[model samples]
Target chain A: MTKRVAIIASNGGLFDAYKVFNIATAAAATDQEVDIFFTFEGLNLIHKEANKQLPMPEGKEHFADGFAKANVPSISELAAIAQEMGVKFIGCQMTMDVMGLEKEDFVDGIEVGGAVTFLEFAKDADVTLTF
Target chain B: MENLKANVILDAKGLACPMPIVKTKKAMNSLEAGQVLEVQATDKGSKADMKAWAESTGHHYLGTIEEGEVLKHYLRKSSKDEASEKKHPNVINNEELEKKMEANENIVIIDVREAAEYAFNHIPNALSIPLGELKERINELNKQVETFVVCRTGNRSDLAAQKLAAHGFANVINVVPGMSGWIGKTTGINK
Candidate 1:
């Protein structure tokens, strides 16, 4: 049976990045339906400019550098991979306005919205979360 | 009778934290503010996750309904009055930021690695809290200043970021690569 899941996000921290893909990928792997909602800081992660700038963590800079050195995809790239594999992307309108980003600022594939819009999405979700 | 309009439903299943949010953001943008957006997902953490997103981002959560095994979410766009009030999305790149806290400031660094790995070496002023324990001890974090998360690599730290972001931590940073890339001298481990 298909399960509905909703994820709410506002932070673009490295750990959060991991969570973003981990949860989405796992859900896909498990054959459940998933929906992701990006808001506040979380919107930055989906923005083309900010997403590209995700840095090497304090302690793990080497690993990231090594991956970059090896030409392996960065975390964002991996995220794209997951998206291609089947994760939907959404951007919060209020967040976009405060950041001064337009639909153009985001990557090629993303949806934008406001609170009531997201609530409608969340209302029927079997699982929902705010990240 | 209520008017019914077609909404673009995006299936974000088999994905993780930021991806869900990312996809939702995209779908909402493609839609008219007053239209409905239905998202189907399977992440166990989606319940409260969507609610908070709805509240902070200006979406009206119509409510949720469980059908068989799958759950469905219903949300509506804000009226023009509510739509004008915009908010910002805070995205912090661990590798991109250089944070320095003042002495006695409230800053916590979480090493989301195995105890053995953390015991070997970690950054100064960092706490060893594996990612597995994060959910249970999330309240330990201070929402005020800065809370940095790290792992052997960047993978786990991203997980930490998702949990902390969802839990409403205002200032959080996820260090890329985690301890594996720490260039400075390590504070000797518990060993």
Candidate 2:
């Protein structure tokens, strides 16, 4: 059975980016349709400006560094990879306004909307994740 | 039955972040303003990224519906085209981007890795702008220069370059292999 997975991102740190990318990628690999909604702080993940400066975790050489050092795609790269593999990326509209960012702050290829928009999509999802 | 005109069927199945949007943007770009691009995908993170992408970029979200595992994204292109009127090439490869950087005398290099990674080792003259702080500090850099953004490998930088280009930073570039491919001298992070 095909399952629909929705991941909610609220963290923008490297660890957060790593986790979000990994989970989303895994879902795509399993042939499950995936949708990621970045909200609040999570919006930072997609914020073209903010996403660049996320902090690396302290004393941890987990996924983020390993991915970078090993030449594996980083979260953003994985985002594109996931897309290539079949994943959807969305940014919360309400969050964008709340954060006082204009449309120019995001990357070129993204869709932006609010909770109403997200819930409309999430309502039918088989798996919804809030990370 | 769902009205085909109202339904947005975006094929982001084989693409990621900017690609989904890049595909959608292209679909929307060719259309008359106000036309909607419906996107479908399996990347769970796209759920939010799509909406945010729309909002900031002046697009409208009609809705998202799940058909089996695929989530359908409905987006409407905004009528406003004043700031984003110019059409940019949709797809850019690494070699093409590299040649441009090599030719440019004032390319701004950005490193999205942590300060430690940067301290431990980084490309020479690369600006250390961790992803988390990129937004707040992006303006600090001069947009007029050809900006080259990179992460540990190439993912974050790819996204960063796309983000910069999307925001009208016309001369931005993404470095593939990032610091991982730095053939020059290396630095170490002291803890």
Candidate 3:
């Protein structure tokens, strides 16, 4: 039984990136279908450069050190891992319009669409996660 | 002492949580139905993980034999009728990985660590493809050759290693202790 997973990536912060990739890859590795919808600030995660500038959350200055020491894949690297695991990536078009960003602003191959498209994926999904 | 033989035997000493289990799962997948996989590990928790993993995957957990500091755990692969177990095999320690890179020609080492870490310190001649960018940028590397992946430790690279294997990279190795314990020459932006 292949489970369907739909993720709403709305935060686009360091924490969110970590969570998003882990969940997406974990599900995909297990043969589960995963779709991630990047909306609002979440769209930043799909950007070429802005995603790297995401600051490790405040009050956790040493958290990144722990990740580094533990060899935790960076957020972008996690994106690659997730994709390779067959997780589909979607960037929200409405969010881009509101933020004045073009399709070229995001990473390659990420489908740019509206919430209607995302909802269609979410409709039959067995699990819906928001980060 | 009788020399031990197994369809697949994994040496996992001095490693921490998740790694032993991860490697064991990977090793088991390479075997055919009913083949035995022996895991010699130092971590105490692997004993439990092994049993739990076998149960979950429908494989038979034969049990563990403890000798001195090492524990040898045996597991029998499930029958063909059983569901397939997920695996990400082919792990390499820092020493073995470094030696292979030193000796072998046309071996590509992709560092999946973050850019900041890559800029600060990275293996000489290793390409930077941080984990987050890996899925999108996998096309950059040639899948035909041996690709050694490294991260801060082995955790991220293990994941990346699995991704590469899944993506049809015939020969993929995850370097343990990553760049943190690498003993070879490294040239980064800071250097």
Candidate 4:
């Protein structure tokens, strides 16, 4: 049976973006249905402009070189792979409203919805996680 | 081992978790079913992760070979016929299998999951014949015995059961919702 995985992404740091995309893409690769909901600061992950400005959290910038050395995909590249793999991306509408952002600010192929919309999908998910 | 050739060779060396799998999935999408893919990776965990990922996706994980620091993982893409979600005509739930075990009924239980998966936990006394090796090892089993086939879920076991039936093994039953839903007695390395 194919399992459904639902993830709530609430952070948008460089490492956090990697964590979200890693889990999302891995689950999608294994034939599992996956949905990622970006809320609060996590919206930056899907924001076309904000995503390009993803900063290494505080003093952890030194690890970026190691990540590059390890051939870790950039945040935008992982996001593109996740999109191609059919991992559904949902941006929180409430967050966008609070941040004065519009749908045009996000990358293509993402659904904008509120908490209830995400809960509808997450309630019956086989695995529900927050990052 | 020297003569084994893959239709495609993916170099994932220096990549960590998810990159290897992500690239493998992309490459697999371009190949025809039954074609083999060889992935070269330096990540130590790729061996087990590749096996688990392939098994769950209905692909054939042909095991891994290590050369120096690089692990070479071979996987055969599943054919459309196999991925059509075919189920064996004869089936039993996990509970029925557990009951039979509790009653001490003489039956053969074959676990078709990868060795790594089986090593974690499996029904006691279940034979570990992975689906990829089932055809070659078919002769080792008695065709007369009542056999129950299982995997992490039921997909691989369904395919294994069909293969057994085709090989003239009668009384073969696929245990649906296999070990994933099994609440029976299990003994393995993790236990």
Candidate 5:
């Protein structure tokens, strides 16, 4: 049976940024239908400028430096990979409005939507997860 | 990490959950049984996913070596066997087996999951002959033993049960829905 995976990206810290990208890319690799909905703090994940700089939740440069040393792909890079793997990226409209962001603020190909749109995808998803 | 050799080296760095597992599965399919694959990943989730996936698919989850943020996972192919369309007979639920265990039954439980999976978590006392190794290790199982084979989701176990039957074992039964569905008592080495 073909597996459908839906992920809700509601966090956008360094760790969470990596987590959502990793999972979305991985699920896409499985040839499963995969979608990610950006909401609340997760909205930062789709914002082009914000995603480029993943703020360290801990007050330290070591986290970002550590990622560099380990050759970990940046969240933007991982997002690109996830997109290439056919994973759909959706930016939450309500959050976008609340945050005073425009469509251009998000990465290219991010489909703007609200909770109802994501719920439709989630309803049929065999596996619905959150990050 | 430096000395590890593999037929395929999957660079899943920065990739999460299903992606690392997904890429590993694809890499594994390209190889013959017993060939090794090394996966390097950055996402922490890949640690558990790789271990669980390798066991689910019957590949040897040799273990992971971490270098800073990077996780290097090694897997050796167990066998070339794939899940067959043909059904294996007499599938039983976890409840029935739990009852059997409670009743002090003589049934022999063969865990067809990878050694990592068996080690991580499984029914207590289940034998570890991964599905990949099942063809060669069939002799290790007593022919007269009442066999119960299991995997994570029952896919590999189904294949193992059928394989045992083809090899002249008559008392093999596959555990339906596998260990993932089992709610009774369980144990493992990892926890």
Candidate 6:
């Protein structure tokens, strides 16, 4: 049976972004339905331009070469794969409003929703996680 | 094992978590059901994770063979017949099962999810019999006992229940929306 996995992403650092996408893609790979709600700094992960500039957390730059050597997929690459795998990406509407952002600022296929909308989906989810 | 052949080979070596699974999922999509996929990965976790992912997705995890630092995981895409959800005739809901447990009913609950999943959280006293190992382990179960089969969802337990019924277990019941919807108490290694 397909299980629903709901994730709340509120961090935009490299590590956090990987965590969110990794879990999302893995869940999706297992034929699980996945929805990721991006709020606060996490909204940058879905931003058309901001996502490309995701940086490793302070003092963790040394891991960049190691990550590249290990052939880790870029954040954008993983996000694209997650999208292709049908992982739903939802940008928090309230955060967008508070930050003076618009739908055009996010990547295509992103659904803008508020907490209520996210909760509606999460309430029925088999697994609810935060990153 | 030497004679086994895969229709497609996916090189996921040097990749980290989610990449192996992501690439495998994409590769599996192109193959016809029942076709085999061999994934080569250097990630230490790929063996167990790949098997759990394949089984949970209705695919058959053939096995993994390690060659030095690389692990080759074999999986067979599930045929249409196995992919489709088939419920057993005898059924019970999670609520009903919880009620039975609360009442201290003398019943056997067999969890058919992977060992990792069961280790994280499972019903107390629920026997761990992963669906892949059910046939060989079926003898461990008493046919006379009233057994309830469960998994993350009803899909796997449904198949397990059918298998139990076919094996002449008369009172096997499948718990629908199994552990995913279970709100009752659970005990596992993670706890």
lDDT by candidate, in order shown: 0.64, 0.66, 0.76, 0.86, 0.78, 0.86
Candidate 6 regions off by >4 Å? B82-191
> Per-residue alpha-carbon lDDT of model 1 for A34-129, expressed as tens digits?
667888878767777787776555777667655444333356775676677566777888878887889998777887877777788778888786
Q: In Å, what is the interface RMSD of model 5?
A: 4.7
CAPRI grade, predicted model 5 = incorrect
Using Cα atoms, each model's DockQ against the true complex is 0.03, 0.02, 0.04, 0.58, 0.23, 0.56
lDDT by residue for model 3 (A10-111), tens = 986788887887767656644578999999998888788988877777888788777776555667776776676578889998889889999888777789
For B2-52, candidate 5 gives per-residue lDDT tens digits of 234456788988654555676787687798765667889887877787777
For candidate 1 chain A, the 10 contiguous residues with the lowest summed lDDT are A65-74
Candidate 2 per-residue lDDT over residues B52-86, each given as its tens digit: 76665556654566677787776755654323322
Scored by TM against the true chain B, the candidates give: 0.46, 0.45, 0.53, 0.59, 0.61, 0.60
Instruction: Estimate, for each residue in A1-131, the C-alpha lDDT of model 4 and write its tens digit.
Output: 77999999999898889889999999998888999999999999999988877989898889978987887777888899999999999999999999999989899999999999999999889999898
Q: Write the per-residue lDDT of candidate 5 for residues A19-129, one digit (tens) a residue.
A: 888777766665578999999999888788898877787877666667666556777878887887788989999988998998898888889999999999999999899
Ranking by TM-score: 4, 6, 3, 5, 2, 1
Count of clashing residue pairs in every prediction: 115, 74, 12, 0, 7, 0
Fill in the DockQ of model 5: 0.23
lDDT value, residue B25 of candidate 2: 55
| Candidate 1 chain B weakest lDDT stretch, 10 residues | B82-91
Pairs clashing within candidate 5: A22-B15, A22-B16, A23-B16, A26-B18, A26-B19, A27-B19, B34-B77
Angstrom error of the Cα, residue B80, model 3: value is: 3.8
Strongest candidate by TM-score: 4
Model 3: residues with Cα > 4 Å off, grouped in runs: B1-6, B9-31, B36-77, B82-191
Model 6 gets an lDDT of 0.86
lDDT of 6 by residue, B1-191 (tens): 23345678999998888789988988999998656788999999898898789778878775677788998887877767544666689999999999988887667999987654565568988988878789999989999888999986688899999999999999999998888789998886425
Better of 1 and 4 by lDDT: 4
Candidate 5: misplaced stretches above 4 Å? A58-61, B1-48, B55-191
